[model samples]
Structures are given as structure tokens and as C-alpha cells.
Target: MGDQSDKGQHPANSPTPYAPYAPYRRPGRRPYSVRMTTGGSGIAHGFPHLDTVRAALAALFRRLSHDTVSTFPTSVLPVDVAFDDTEDVHLGAQRIARAVVHQLHLPDARIVITFREMEHAATVELTAGPEYFVELNDRFRRHRKDIGAALAHEVTHVWLHRLDLSFPGTRDNEILTDTAAAYLGAGWLLLDAYREHGPFSQKLGYLTPEEFGYVLAKRADFFDEDPAPWFTSPQAYDAYTAGRARARQDARRPPLAGAGWAARLRYAKDRRAAQDPRRTAGPVAGPGDGYAFEPAAGTGAPLRVSFPCPTCWQRIRVPVRGHLQARCGLCKTLLDCDT
Candidate 1:
């Protein structure tokens, strides 16, 4: 009787799968929701089309060919392209590097591109691979064109860095990189690509589709053509439509006064003076002074003070100065003084 048998007894306590274990609470002030949602500190919207992108690059290439001065060193860089076996993002970065290498004519610098499956989602990082190495994002694999464009853009940054052209804190440095790309004959393509995938959003400090268009437009103006037609994308279309409308409106609006009006009046006066010598000679001293004035001509006698309306043929007085508003006696239509 010292110990009771409990082999057949059911245990009073049990654990349920659905039992709440205080929910997985995040530590340290919830780590800020906005910070968590914003994936990276880069802009991430508005991408452009492929053809426009190519055209822009081709244009840049052509320009670089024509430039007498060279911003890049005489020696060229070597570039190696490869994809990450484990991650899909590496494909895009690899493709972009290849495109850049293909387009560039460097001869001395060695560049190795490798794809690595890293913890980060997708990014392009520059490193010293004995020469230079870049790690590309996996997402780029699906968007080949964007990859090429983005890689070209970053490569440009590298070029600037090597040249000691980059300045800290000033937007001018970024602009210089962009300008250098264009000047060397790839600006339009880069701009097109930028428009296609460039960052945009007031809240995010990214370039908007419109801003991309505007930049492309400026680039086009620099080259003297409509960049819109070169590359066709939703962003390009919207920009072109808006730009065309603005141009038309601008054309219709009267120019500022002064020189424009003076020119117009001068032309008008010259034509009138050529047609009537007497009018230009001098005003008559008096209506009937000794000056032998020609008879009131044109209709044999002076035009009748009142005459038949041309439309209804009713007698009507064409007012002196021909500046009075009147109604047709027969047609009852309002008539302008000049008419």
C-alpha cells in the first residue's frame, strides 16, 4: 500500500499544438516597420524598353568614337563574365558585365565578374579581384536588358572612380558620370535604360518616369533629335506626348514684345510704303488746298455714304474710319467694322 499503481491512469496535463506561445515578438522597439519594408537604400521603380536602351548606347558609342579627346586611359581593361551556380541573380550581373566588356575597348586593366549566392537579395558590389570584380544580383537574369543597362551604368561609376573624377556629396559627380557615358557615345542608351529602370518616387528619392524622359529629352537635344522616337516604352510614350504638347503650346504662345513687334511693324511699313508712294511722301496740307488732288477715284464718284450690302444688297452707309459695329439692314446680321 506504500505506492499505488498508476500504470492505467491518464495524465491530467497535456500539450496542444495550437497553444499560443506568446507569439514570436520581435526584439528592440520592433526594429522600425518602415525600415523593414524598405529593402535597400536605393531607388527601385520605372524601367525603360530594350530598343530605346540599345539606341541610346549605340548613340553614345558613336559619340565616343567622334570625340578627339579621350577621358579614359590609353590602356583598356579586361573583363570576365560568369554566373553564380547557386543563385539566379548572378545571371543578370554576369550578362551585364559581358555586355560592358564587349562594348569597351580597354587593353590594360583586368576585370573578373563572378556570381555568388550571397545572403543579400540582389546587389552589384565592386571589389578588388587582383584587378576589379563585381558581384551581381540574381533578379537581373530575367531582365537581361535591364542587367546590361545597370551594369553599364555601374561600370561608368567604376571608370569615374579610376579616373579620380568622382566627388563626394555633390550631385555634379553623378551627373558627370552620366555625362561621361553620353559623351563617350552611350549616353542615350544609358538614359533610355535609366528611364526604363531608373529609380523614381518623391518619397524614395528615385528618378520618376517623367524625370527619366526629361533627362533623355535633354540628351536628345544635346544630340539634336527626338530621343523619344529612338526608344519606345510606356515611359517614353508618356514623355513624348507631354513634351510634344508643351512644344506646340510654346509655339502658339506669342513671343515677348519689343524686338519681335518692331520687326513686324518694319516689314509692314516697308510693304505699305512700296505700294503707295504718295502716302509715304507726306500728308496733304489741307483737304482741298491748291494741291492738285486726284478726284475721289475707284468708283467714278466718291463711294456712296450709304451702299447696298454685299450679302443682302441693301443700301448701307459704310462708316468713316470703318470702325463702327453695325447690323445689316436686311440680313439683320451683326457686321464687324472692318468687314
Candidate 2:
């Protein structure tokens, strides 16, 4: 990693050797089984970064603690980043940069904003100082509206760096950054930055548009906030809808009280398997199942089931008694379970 490296290739996720949509894998990271690489589609849609995104959410609660995570109850306001085309480029960029810093709660951090011709959307130096230098792609000089989106991402890098939280590799780590940006209230710009039409497309941040929506949806659910009215791009709203639907499904997984009949039926069968004397109970017995069963802790103790907390994806274990509310120790999200 060098200062020249734009947060995993250039921040602009176009298909290229240095771009995100390209089939570029870091040296030691394992390749995705799916063809998540860039193609004629331009922007890769769906939940390609899903696993990493979930892990990122868990990492957020783990590092920042639930109380700190709850403090970001509101997303960045549209007024905070508004830029008039007639506004001075340097001054306006600095203003937007400061807005991002303030919204992200980097009270002591000072950002030096500059623009130059570059392949990435933006880059920020992760330094120990109270001052950070951010270089924006020269294109942003003309496309001022997205300056907020770029700074939202780069400033979040500073926030995460300060928290000293990161994932293993470049790709997952970038996903963590993206997830933190969205869930912590500054990332809606990333989703709003997505615009695709007539073979031309632009997307900011590492998470796919849907993934951005998913994290946003998760944030909204926790804070009881709605971001639908903030999106100027219909495509972004639609992607949010799709991602929100997916996020809502997390609560409907088997063992959760809200689960549908089919899932509940499956859970019943799995429960039977766990109780069967011949079957060995373990953390997992099937693929695509969000839960597993473990043997009872003591001779008379009840059999226990383990499932992921819909909020942070942290695995939660509870006794196999019916109608219990489990609160995730990590994110502190309370859930209604029927195990």
C-alpha cells in the first residue's frame, strides 16, 4: 500500500486493472467462487460483497461498542453537502469535506482538500496527526455534486483508522470501510452516487449499490429513520428497496418469531434432527441455514440453538425453549425467537 493507491484500486469502480469491478484479487486473498469481476454490465449488482458486509457490521459493534454505534442516529443531511455549480471549487470542496468530518464526529480532525487528475474518485492519508490530506479526482471539479459522496467515504477512512478497526485483506477491509460509512450515517452519498444508463455507469465506495442499501436499511431499522426521501436518484432508491427487502429477510430467518411457515417448518425438522439420539449436534448441519444446534451444556440442561443476530450477524446461542427474547451482546439488539 502506498499513498498513490486509491483505497483498493481507484475509488471509481469502473472495469480496469486498478478498478473495483475488475477481476483484480490482492496477492494472498482468496478468489470469489462467483464471477464477481467486472463485465459489460459496468456495475456489478446484487449482494456480491454480502459476507464481508455482514462481517463488517459485526466488526463495527465489536470495535466501537454499541453505545458509540448508537450515537450516529442520523445520516448526513443533504443540506450539509449541497454545492452550487457556481460555487468556488476549492472552497466548496473544503466546505463539503468539513461537513463530512463534522457529521462523522471527527471533531479534532482537519482535512486538507485538493484536486488533481486521477483515476480514483478520492484518496485520504491514514495518518496519526489531527490533520489529513485528501486528493479528489480532477473530474470532481466539474462534478461537484458527488464531492460529498467522495468525502463521505474518505473521511470515514479517517474515522475507522482512528478506531483502529479493520478486516484481514485489502478487499474485505475496504468493504468494512464502506459498511462503516453507510451504517454510521455518512454513506448514503455512496448509494446516491450510483447512476447507470445508456452503457455509462458510476458507483462510489466498494459495496455494491444493493449492499449500500442493505447497510442503510439496517441503520434505518435501528434508528427508526427513513432515507427514502433523501435520494435524488431513482435507481439508488430502487436499489435501497431491494437491499432493504434483503435486510428484512434477516429477521425472518428460521427460529425468529417472525419467520414464515416454510422456514418454520424447516426449523422444526432441524430441531427434530438435533434431538434425535443418532444425530450429532453441531454448530451447523446444513448450508444456507443461519442457525445450528449444539448439545446441552449439562446433563439436565436443555438443548441449545445458535443463530445469527439479525443486526450485526453475530452468532447467538440460546436454550431450545419456546418464546424467548434474545438480546445480542455485541450490538445489543433484542430479538424475538421461537426456539
Cα lDDT of model 1 by residue, 133-206, tens digit: 44333333343444444455556556555444443443434444444444343434443443334443111112
TM-score of 2: 0.86
The candidate that wins on TM-score is 2
Instruction: Evaluate model 1: give its TM-score.
Output: 0.38
Q: What is candidate 2's lDDT per residue for 144-255, written digit by digit as tens? A: 8989988888888888887788788878878988899899888998889887766667788788899999999999999999999999888899999999999999989878
Off by over 4 Å in 1: 1-98, 101-105, 108-110, 115-130, 170-172, 187-207, 224-232, 240-339
How much is the lDDT of residue 44 in candidate 1?
36
Q: Model 2, residue 164: displacement in angstroms? A: 0.9
